[model samples]
Target: MIPITTVKYPVNEFFQTIQGEGLYTGTPALFLRLQGCPVGCPWCDTKHTWEKSDNARVSAEAMLAKTAPSEAWAEMSAVEILNVIEAQGFTAKHIVITGGEPAMYDLMPLGQELEQHGYQLQIETSGTFPLHVTENTWVTVSPKLDMPGGYLVRPDCMQRADEVKYPVAMEKHIDALDLLLKNCPPRQDTIIALQPISQRPRATELAMQVCIERNWRLSVQMHKYLNIE
Candidate 1:
């Protein structure tokens, strides 16, 4: 087994951007996107991150230099990643750990290291894999149901989420979420938000209607609208 100190995360991309969704919308954040996910969501925008190609591994510098999205990834230990962040002089103290299903690997090491330096952590995950993040990490479990990967959302993950940001495109999607909510209730104060699939008009209208009726929040993929990274 790899030693804890040497534990490296296969990173797809890292950058500072405005958080475009969930309870922390509009927050200035540093996004550290990890590579690899088997929980296939058909509408996933970062399909380049779905596979960690062995031949695509490159130096951290080369990975960061990437201007276009591709399968290229770099393995960086907690310390190395921290150094890069510091070197870039990033102003965002709130770091978002996302994927390609980031929870597929243990995040505690990265979390602990980041937190030690006074950065708050948040993870966006499909509540399928077992979560192994810092206790203080804000968990956002966007339940993925009936995906091609054949993974089931974990009750523990739903219960632990600080926010449940479910993606919706139809009445059936809402129905599925209702069932999940009933079966795996989140914390009493857990924020529930609906994100329209790819800003489709029907999906957005459905999401807005449901959010209005249920007092849920709406996540409009602000980055997409703003045409920002």
Candidate 2:
């Protein structure tokens, strides 16, 4: 159990509309994009998030002001954060805790507070950190190979992931995915989604075949193809 006494000063970005992909697609939710990711996926869309120095260290109030005022957000204490969410007119039960790898911080307090309020927590991670999350929280692990900081694949990440979302560009990515999959438990409930590298037809086709051969699922980046951010 994470100590609630620990203060959570999330160097967070803004809240947005519905998530673009994953199990929470189409559902309206708040996006907490915490800055600082070292995992370098060649095709990472939010490359801005890659460098922590690139983002301004703004107060949560300043961040919230950019959105609807009635929509609540505050540079808050964990307890204060819950109050802000209640203040927000947001009725959506889903809350996406994403990042520059949100796992970099201990999320037990945040997850516990949100879950207490009946909000379903979902974390989008790179399968690097030993995730501090609730049992019910959905973990989407998009593994990157040979990234900066010399972070190799860790088994704890693959094993904990409820879904394995891979970004496919060339055959090499499949090799990387297979390497990671070798460590995971052979559970039928584990969802494997193959998203093509930048909507490339050839990459998509390759991914489709891989999926069909292994009975894996293809996760098209519907938002990217539609040109929605």
Candidate 3:
């Protein structure tokens, strides 16, 4: 693990966009996508981000040229990141610290700075790493079960999440979610969301039924539907 304070994180990309999933869906947000992930889910859209070495480092200006996917990234410190965000003139008050597993790095410094500057912080993680962020940070744990990486979702991560979002592509996926939920701490306010995998008809149907049966929320990837990043 890298030292949080001194590390210049390998940033895959960063941009202002609409919150396309989970509880913050539809909200304006600045996405700070970090690099490197070992939790290799087969259905992962950002496959280019799987390996840190796959991307050559670029300037923050070059990295933000477009919101589209790219095999390019940059290294930036916490303060440098804030500078880039400021330079971009993003008005979105929400900051989504996402990944290639953003939890792959200690995020307390960056998250704390963003919160201190009045930005609402949210972390989108695979629930495979021990989460280390401020208490106010909204942790969204989208547990990846039996993925190619063979990493088990950490029970402490699920317990820490404000929302547990499950991507359902089949009945077994739902079953996995049920088993994962058993490990979560009994919190009345903990939100459970069932997101259909890639908006597939069968998956959507299954997710809708499960959400209704369990009284969970449905999280369809709105960015994919709206043709946005």
Candidate 4:
């Protein structure tokens, strides 16, 4: 077993940016991207965060130093993080908790801390681990398929998801989505989105067609296509 003591988060980068997916899409938010993922998605754009040890580990203060003050960041305790958000003069109330698979960490403290301060917490996860989070937090579980360092996305993860944002490149990915959905209890409010893999137009066409036929939603990586970080 990898010793928990040796497991320090790489934290490749963090910044304030408009959230680019799911229900909170287009909302200006603070992003805390903890680095390290075991569930490998073949097309993961942020694969740079895959290793916990290789990337430089720095204090949250050092991480914040790389960005602009107006960009809204500071090395923060749960309480201190809230203060920084208030100080930033941001009117947006969303807080996005993303990562190289944030489910790898016990995020209860961080989630509870954010909620106490009135911030709506949204977690973008690969659903490889059983999630431990506050009841009110919104979960976007983007399920992973067979890849190196193979991990099974637990059934509980899908059942708990507020949204299932599946990435698609071809029929195999759609098959994976169908398999996952087979286990999830059908509900009207359960959001099903097909995000084109890597903004490919052919893939987008497939996703759009499926969305139109099933009354599901399409999740375009608008941030990438729009050339925003």
Each prediction's Cα RMSD? Answer: 1.3, 3.9, 2.2, 4.9
TM-score of 1: 0.97
Q: Tens-digit lDDT track for model 2 on 85-177? A: 667766777888886778887788888877887888889888877888888989898877777656765678777788888888789989878
- Candidate achieving the largest TM-score: 1
Per residue, candidate 3 scores C-alpha lDDT tens digits across 12-59 of 888889999999999999998887899988878888788887447788
Model 1, 27-145: lDDT tens per residue?
99999999999998898998999988899999999999999998999999988988998899999999999999999999988888889999999999999999999999999999999
lDDT of 3 at 62: 79
Residue pairs in candidate 1 whose N, alpha carbon or C atoms collide under 3 angstroms: none
Rank all candidate structures by their lDDT, best first, as comma-separated numbers: 1, 3, 4, 2
Worst 10 residues of 1 by lDDT: 1-10
lDDT of each: 0.93, 0.73, 0.85, 0.74
lDDT of 1: 0.93
Better of 1 and 2 by lDDT: 1
Give the residue spans of candidate 4 off by over 4 A.
1-11, 67-76, 86-90, 184-188
Comparing 2 and 4 by lDDT, which wins?
A: 4
